[model samples]
Target: MFCFLRKLHKMESTWPHSLQFLLFFSLLFSMAFSKSVIEPCNSSTSCNSLLSYLLPSDMKLAEISTKFNINPIELVGSNNLDQQTSQTLILSAKTTIKIPIQCPCINGIRQSVSTLYTVQPIDTIESICTGFGNLVSPDQIKAANDLDNSSSSLESGQSLKIPLPCTCFNNTDNGVTALYLSYVVREGDSLDSIAGAYGTTVTDLVGVNKLGSPSIDPGDILAIPISACSSANMNLYNDSLLVPNGGYALTAGNCIFCSCGPRNLSLHCVPSALSASCPNLQCKGNNLFIGDVEEELMGTGCNVTTCLYRGYVNHKVLSSLSNTYRAQCTSNHSNPLSPSLPPSSIGIPSVHVLPSLAPAAAAPFAGHGFGSGPTAVQIASSATVSTRTSNSAPFILVFLLALMLVFIPFDPNVYS
Candidate 1:
């Protein structure tokens, strides 16, 4: 009887330890397979951040959960799969799957940074979000914009803000670190100027932006890599080294000079005085003429004299950098006499001109010989008349043909 009692007591003692071991491993297993929780946006309760993933082939629910470190049950519920449980079920091939992305939250509000995106023609919210790797959900976008429904259409040229997940890099403190700033390229900006202004190199800018070439168009938003020099440190005159050639710099609270040079090569500054003397000329009623000017500017200098005789007058002066002056020129007289002057004589060299104008348009006073209002206005009026005549040629031809047909006798006999 004593032996039996002893054996029973020993079993009771071991029972507690067995239970403890099981509980300990249960905690560990839960921790190992735990998934990130989707946070709510500050403004809306329905907003949930998500990421889209394209499956290469058909995969089982359990397999996907395991691969992405998500709970099988949660995955099934979130995706609305037909499966009732977290069992092995095959999902269709090429299926776009939505995975919940974790976002930083403060006081129950998500802290996500966003940038503006201009909607292009035929662009849908789903398509735009998908293009961005699904870092944001359709619902989140709708909530951010306060749209009535997700099915609402977007018009071309409309802008939308897109949110992105913030990541904390552990090695940022010790390694080469850079902060990104959003910049819009203006009419006179070049990659070299942008890099110099921000205290970074053109190579880094191109790499970060993934630009096919150094050329950038107006209204293009560039992700500028800024390592040092904030808004307070920008100085134009004394900091000539920081200003790109053909690009302007701010000095004494004003933008001064034009930094210009060869594309993708070293640049030099052109005196504002010389640039002012260069004529603004555009070919009347000819987009082709403007294209020629752009092409020539890309090469060496503007053929001011030839362009002037072609009825090209500058409408507006864009910027004078290096030896080239970019302007909107127009001429009233169409088919003007072409001059026999050599190309060299027509093209103004950078060395002959003097620098004077400050880059800032709002500068207190104009530079020496900067403003030429009456002459410019007279040229523009003449150019407008010529442009109108050229534009009406096709209409005139059509009208003349119609009149001829009305006067002619019936052509039924010819058809027979």
Candidate 2:
């Protein structure tokens, strides 16, 4: 410690004031690196999950949605915003948002496969690490990118691989379709408080994580379960899905889109009128298209038949017809038959990692059906934003060091 103090004294005299500040700040902050969130994946069944993203700068919802390849509607609804919230609205920097992704076991770990970050001139490895709310580790980033100690500077425009935290514990929890979110534990966050915010129970959480005790620490990643409006996809190409209760999923090679609502836990699938050319979506002899419905009142109630999206097969859309009770007009059905629940232990498809459990039960969700977009849910934010911060830490340390360098003379003789 004394030798380091003497080195600081020498640098203080030789370096100018500005250099002194920069050097001291970098040295102090770089000493302590943040820990990575921990959740392992060993299951074959894949499911949807959420990644808590801290915005690096002011950005529009549409741009972010496009960057993540998600429907604008799902992005808005996931944040508990109005379905009609303009895509161009600029959200502030430092605001944390949940990003839904498919988490499958990749080489023994559960993580979404392909999230990339482009280097900027002003970005140091430390800044990039903090930009992700410290959920990402500097060492992980360096290991993934094969980077050296020169993190203070980097070649602009180079892409960096981000190994995000996520899970898919068989996509069901306590016998219902679920979405799992990788939530980082925070200080002052009791287990019950975390459970209550997302409308789940502490027992379910403890069981899902296979914990021996209820104790948790900051930076630990817990697989949080969220009940989803279930999917009954026929597994046409391994693209099975179950959307988080207010979110949307684009499937069938973008020819079909699905959304889930709080009304009865059904997945509403439809022909997305986006520029992609879809296969013939007509219900033969029924004068209907995917998501289209026809209703006739029976003696006691209503008899409804609708066209549904099953899955994409051989580049052809697989759809079927149902003659069941009046389904909330899809323009979608079914609390999908439950997959055999895996033993509770561990954990996306944003395809939902966590939910505000659901939205308030509303009118039978008569959806946009064709082009405008799916209905939004008034569900609350499911993942908790991390409370860790250190923007002023470097400055504070540098200030204190400056005082020590001048006022406290180093005793080289005593050290010798």
Candidate 3:
């Protein structure tokens, strides 16, 4: 009886140990299965058989959806804390995220936002568009922007507007359909040269032409899209562009360190100072600012008023610029930068500095003769004289008729 009781006690002890072993194996199996299904999430909450992970830099919603065997919208919406809400999210390398056990929202899903990007070196249109979350297809990008689907190369510094996948699913169909315009290739035209000229990508031209070679012959007409022109074809020195100071560097269609020029000054197109096509110093656009200064000189005691007017003419030309140079120049006041001259000798053109040697009535047009043209007041006077002559001529005629009737005989009898 004692031996049998001892055996039973040993068996009971082994049973407790056996139970612990089973529990340990069960937990291990569960962890292994979970690892296969979901990525490891850092949050402490026990996984309800689901997993989550930090997004890789190259990961996109479309790609992630395919990999996880779930809907792209569903996966992105739930996993994205910052993206789910409209609030800004800072996603640095070490940011932690919680992967929910169940999908959060039923009806709504994350959408994509369109983006604009500039082309960089060694970039292909196909690679660039696809690399950025497959937001824009090569065919769609080509079609929307009027690029040739044949080539897929891009030039450095050319900007492209890309559609991005974000929570906001802007029905991209509502966006403007871009058109591609064609330009005849001129002499010395390369694919890159043409792209630069039209502000398009070489890949676009290659896609359009289906050209295997980079060498482009003159007279090869290329199709370019309006977006390319609008975003990429920025010219800082275009005659139409305003130049503020003597020099300006244009980047992304905006000017830096520049000022506005006179309105009427004719802009001369020139090669870009920074770019290959940027205008030289002799180009009309280059002189836009200097021409403005020259015009303002007329108002500020300089005798030049015929300069062109742009947006900033009135401010620079009409108002006297505060003299930067306090010391006077020459006894005759010819040179602008002479030192030894007196404060009284410091002269501006015809402004307050120069007293009129001529009479007050003829003060403005004094040296200027009649053939040169009438002064502003003279022109006004001529207009008044013409109006009075028109009004008094009729009265004079009637008065002359009355005098004739008084002096001469009446002719009524002859008519009868």
Largest TM-score belongs to which candidate? 2
Global local distance difference test of model 3: 0.30
Q: Which tens-of-lDDT digit does each residue in 65-110 have in candidate 2?
A: 7655556765664554533344446776655566777667777666
Ranking, TM-score, top scorer first? 2, 1, 3
lDDT of 1: 0.37
lDDT by candidate, in order shown: 0.37, 0.58, 0.30
**Collision count of model 3:** 39
Candidate 3, superposed: residue stretches over 4 Å from native: 1-113, 164-416
Quote each prediction's TM-score. 0.21, 0.60, 0.18
Candidate 2 C-alpha error for residue 182, in Å: 1.8
Off by over 4 Å in 2: 1-47, 62-87, 148-158, 186-188, 209-218, 233-239, 252-255, 273-281, 292-302, 313-318, 325-416
Candidate 2 lDDT: 0.58
Tens-digit lDDT string for candidate 3 (1-416): 23432443445444453453354345333322210000112232221111222333433445444433444333332332212231223333222221212212112322121235667797777566434423334554564456765566677998675522121111010121122333333345566654554334565445433444555433233333222011112232322332211112122121111211112112322111222221212214323221222222322354322122222221221112222332322233333221222222322111111111111211111011122332222222211100001112344446544543443334444346
Residue-level lDDT tens digits of model 1 in 1-416:
23432443445444453453354345333322211112233433222233334444567767666544555533442343432232645655545444433334444444343356778998887677545534445555676677766255888998776654322121011122222333434457677776665555566555444455666654344544322111222222223222221222222211112222213212222212213243332344433211132223223333232221111123342222112343422342222233333222332222211121111221111111222223222211211100001222345446544543443333344446
Clashes of each: 28, 16, 39
Candidate 1 weakest lDDT stretch, 10 residues? 382-391
